[model samples]
Target: MAGAAPILETRDLTIRFGGHVAVDGVSCAFERGTLTAIVGPNGAGKTTYFNLISGQLRASAGAVLLKGAPITRLAAPARARLGLGRAFQLTNLFPNLNVLENVRLAVQARAGTGLDFLSMAARRRDLAARAEACLARVRLAERAHASAAALSHGDQRKLEVAILLALEPDIFMFDEPTAGMSVDEVPVILDLIEAIKREGDKTVLLVEHKMDVVRRLADRVIVLHNGALVADGEPAAVVASPIVQEAYLGIRTAP
Candidate 1:
């Protein structure tokens, strides 16, 4: 088990917009079964880095490898098919569909069944059952019949996670997973992430601004500044480092 290759990796990954280099040449590897939290000041390119890796933004330079194979040219949907799942800062769902249908579609997609919803529903009861299980995991079973547009923002976020679960990817990338949720709604997502970590198979990459959440969930922490990887280590060590204290946490000790 020791020395297995990392499930996901970025090799000097970078991207630029005209004159600005949003994500500089940053490289890192993520081993399976570990949760790495990416933290930085606003505009430090954390989300941009995630976008490059997840194929939302193509890299201007460098390579992205999944299990050591280059996938830098792949599109977002291509990356998703190859086991990269991403949950965005804003909820992405079918506003017109009911809660259950949204997840059922994800299940159907993962099963390689065409999206003939009516036909699939008639032929495959297992898809619906699997979707229900994903919803229950996110505490949304009772709202299964509710329209996605009708649910509150917090519930919508939960439904997004359920959809991601239904896809069953090997790598889970969550960008600000708790950004807009109420305090009461934060724990459900956190608990679900903790459960994923407990599974000890899926690799998770989280981009978060909440220090408390990072402290509680990250197995390791990586700090970025000015579009570069500034620090990488255990949570306590990274958080306590002088660079992070001053730049990220806004703690300035006397020179």
Candidate 2:
């Protein structure tokens, strides 16, 4: 996994809705086995860019490449089949499903089968093991049997991470992983992200607002303003850049 080729790349990517350009001329490369943070103020096109990359929305211009092959033309499920996994800003989970079943479903998706149909999922040793392990990684093992809707908000977020981890994707894209969480809950989510990169060698692309979280987790940071990259570099350097402060922080700070 460490020696894998470039997992994802966007070249001059732009997305337009009618006459409005949501993402304009955004080009960036995300390498395999590295954690990257995409940071920006609201309306800076962060979600729009992620939508284009994940194939939920089409790019008005430019191409999205996976492992050096163009995938902009591919659909979301097609991209998922090619080892691309995404977690939305809002928790998207089966509210009625228990944590284990939810994660098992993701594992089954990666395995190209549906355990609930032809197979008894509980008896599938490999899938159960993987799902449980994923839960443990997110600190949700204790609540593996709890209904997703019954869990606390933070636990639901952890469940979201577990579901994605169960997919075992080469490239993991997370949109606002820490949104609407308590101050203490933020680190819990951050710890799960760190565990993914450290233990799974997963390539992570995160869009986050918490400057502290970005500085701690990101190996490289990309800052966007007005739908284009304003700064991209080491966390400290990018945060210190005047363009980033002006667009993102509203006030310039001395470097």
Please give the CA lDDT of all the candidate structures.
0.92, 0.88
Q: For residues 30-88, write the lDDT of model 2, one tens digit per residue.
A: 88778999998999999889889889998889999999899999999899889888898
Candidate 1 TM-score over all chains jointly: 0.95
What does the lDDT come to for candidate 2? 0.88
**lDDT measured at residue 78 in model 1 versus the true structure, 0 to 100:** 89
Which ranges in model 2 have alpha carbons more than 4 Å from their true place?
A: 1-5, 252-255
What overall lDDT, based on C-alpha atoms, would model 1 receive against the true structure?
A: 0.92
- Which candidate achieves the best lDDT against the true structure? 1
Writing each residue's lDDT as its tens digit, candidate 1 over 183-205 gives 99899999999999999999999
**Candidate 2: clashing pairs of residues:** none
